[model samples]
Target chain A: MSERSPKKTDTMTEAERDAYHAEKMKKKKAARDKILATKTEERGLVIVHTGRGKGKSTAAFGMVFRAIGHGFNVGIVQFVKGKWGTGERDVLEKFPEQVTIRAMGEGFTWDTQDRQRDLAAARSAWDAAKAMIADETYKLVLLDELNICLRYDYLPLDEVVETLRNKPRDTHVIVTGRNAKDELIEIADLVTEMTEIKHPFRAGVKAQAGIEF
Target chain B: MSERSPKKTDTMTEAERDAYHAEKMKKKKAARDKILATKTEERGLVIVHTGRGKGKSTAAFGMVFRAIGHGFNVGIVQFVKGKWGTGERDVLEKFPEQVTIRAMGEGFTWDTQDRQRDLAAARSAWDAAKAMIADETYKLVLLDELNICLRYDYLPLDEVVETLRNKPRDTHVIVTGRNAKDELIEIADLVTEMTEIKHPFRAGVKAQAGIEF
Candidate 1:
């Protein structure tokens, strides 16, 4: 897989390649136009990012960055990663007015052994999330690691699903964590399960500061 | 779910909550420290992003952005998407010293009808990718939509796999596209299949400029 083959351009004339590429692009444009014409609606979305892979929260943060790039205000509530100082948090916090980030969790459930305490934190975080959902000012609300909290039974699943269901029609909401509940998945407008095929952790690679965070 | 439940905090004194939280965090820190102690290796990764849903390329770009935040040089070779002007490309291009981007393909197979031309483009893109991989200056190399090119038989699967196998040890490479070849997946260090449960396209929402591009 490591060796490079010779360039194929030597065999084809410039004019021949140009003519072929043009004709090809023409057909593609027509097919694309037909598909684009059929798509016409726009609204808020209930997007759930869950899986055993590494990019669930990373992807959610990417969306937050993307939304901010579009000059949209975003609210981020961390459900299980409050203790770690992440690179994304540092970058996002630079935009004070456009981004509001509240690190609510003490840590993961296994780390915080007290069920009662975990439950309290989850409740408080969910309350904050609901407030953001109701606030029309926020274009996107990210519930970071909410799925893990739900999986641990720290928060009631039914209530969480219902609140997501009733969020403002124009405010996109993103929930990210592993082991997303079936109930939440059912109500989500877009659900992505990031299946992990390989992990560096198993190969003895410790989590890096910027990459893992 | 829309209604707020009574705060459980009402039953516990502030002092009690603080003590409980402090105790729980202490235990968590110990567990986390234990896990962190055993993880010690650091090496580059062969990452693959594929599936039916969106975010394959978005996630790859997110990593590139994250890497750049850490002052790492990155090379991006787009194998299938060159016609559209993307927001990520615009943003990444601002950092000329840290990032090198090559948009090689005219479009996808549907857009470019010439199989021979597509093959030539894929080969050219692969050559660019090999150059980046061999150059130790690049910390990460992203082959955007290379999987699609391989899937469509525009590039040889074995050759691509062999090339990836021989890349620099500390240089990470990410390949993004749906329907990745099994051979690539077999040798990848990490693979994520972004399963799509729901999409706005199905609801008649057209791909918006900043959001989609």
Candidate 2:
């Protein structure tokens, strides 16, 4: 059997072919627009502020303000701190129902050193945070000062990633701490590196309240 | 009909009372000692370098370098940047397996007007980060520039808290950002707020490479 020559018998009128081409182009354009729209829409995000440069938490806080302005609920879980002077807490208290806050209860390691107790506190905080992840209530969750937990082996890095992965699709997480983990970067959609070439502290200036506290 | 009330018994010996008091004091002392030990010995901590001040991310990077010195894996994630123009990424590249770095695709809002696309990119980075949180392979996970996502409503906050709460008990997480939520302050084992008292940018000094990028 003669190999069926590629059938090429369709010789349409110019008008008909032009119409067909136009229709195809329209469909392609529509598809492209849809894809672009999808790509541009906000979904979920992970952010990191690191390096020697300052304003990491300030950036995070700015984002918090931004989210709140947009009417999203916020939650915060701080690890590695117990009781101390707090101005942020006072500000957050204004919107009590919209935000939930919890402390890790360890304070500064320099002051407290009960390993078992500290571990227990971290565990409890973890439990509360886990529940929040499972629930689809809040829009944002901030994990503050978590780096120290890993450095001291208070919590494992593997488990944290798993939980983050499994969180609701709309949830956004922001973590602030020195010494961020490599695994976090691999999975993060965005990462920023803050470098400090100079700091007031290096210039023999002390931390100033209301501005540097 | 000894109707009234039962008679009180106070027959403890002087020695017994002394023993009881001594024991109580001992317990109190033990508790205090335990707390001190945990503070210094447990020493689970993450530093927050934030404010209008400088050296926020630089401090974080210092921790990263220190952790690597101890033969640990590290992860770096940035929230508000679109490029890898700094040496941070270059250094991370040196240990490809040990370090992972990601950038926030939209850079800062000042530089880009495509909030929609920026949000989308932030979301993808967040999705990737979630996976890392769960993987349990990396010892450290650094979330960079996550604050912007929260501020812009690119990601929800409550969910972020949940992930931090549920992360592996052993895994360590570092969060960097500015204006961290008060809720985060409450739960953080350590909470440090960086306030910008003065900045070069405020004086119209443009961000310099190796310093502000």
* lDDT for each candidate structure: 0.77, 0.57
TM-score leader: 1
Regions of model 2 farther than 4 Å from truth: A1-38, A82-85, B1-213
TM-score of chain B of each: 0.85, 0.71
- DockQ, candidate no. 1: 0.30
TM-score of each: 0.80, 0.43
The local lDDT score (0 to 100) that residue B2 gets in candidate 1 is: 42
Worst 10 residues of 2 chain B by lDDT: B1-10
**For candidate 1, lDDT tens digit of each residue in B27-95?**
877878888899897778888989887678777777776776677899989987653244565556556
**Per-residue CA lDDT of candidate 2, range B99-198, in tens?**
7666655544434445456657778778777777777766667776566576555687778767777776545566666766554443344444443433
Model 1 segments beyond 4 Å from truth?
A1-35, A82-85, A105-109, B1-37, B82-85, B93-96, B105-109, B209-211
Docking verdict class for candidate 2:
incorrect
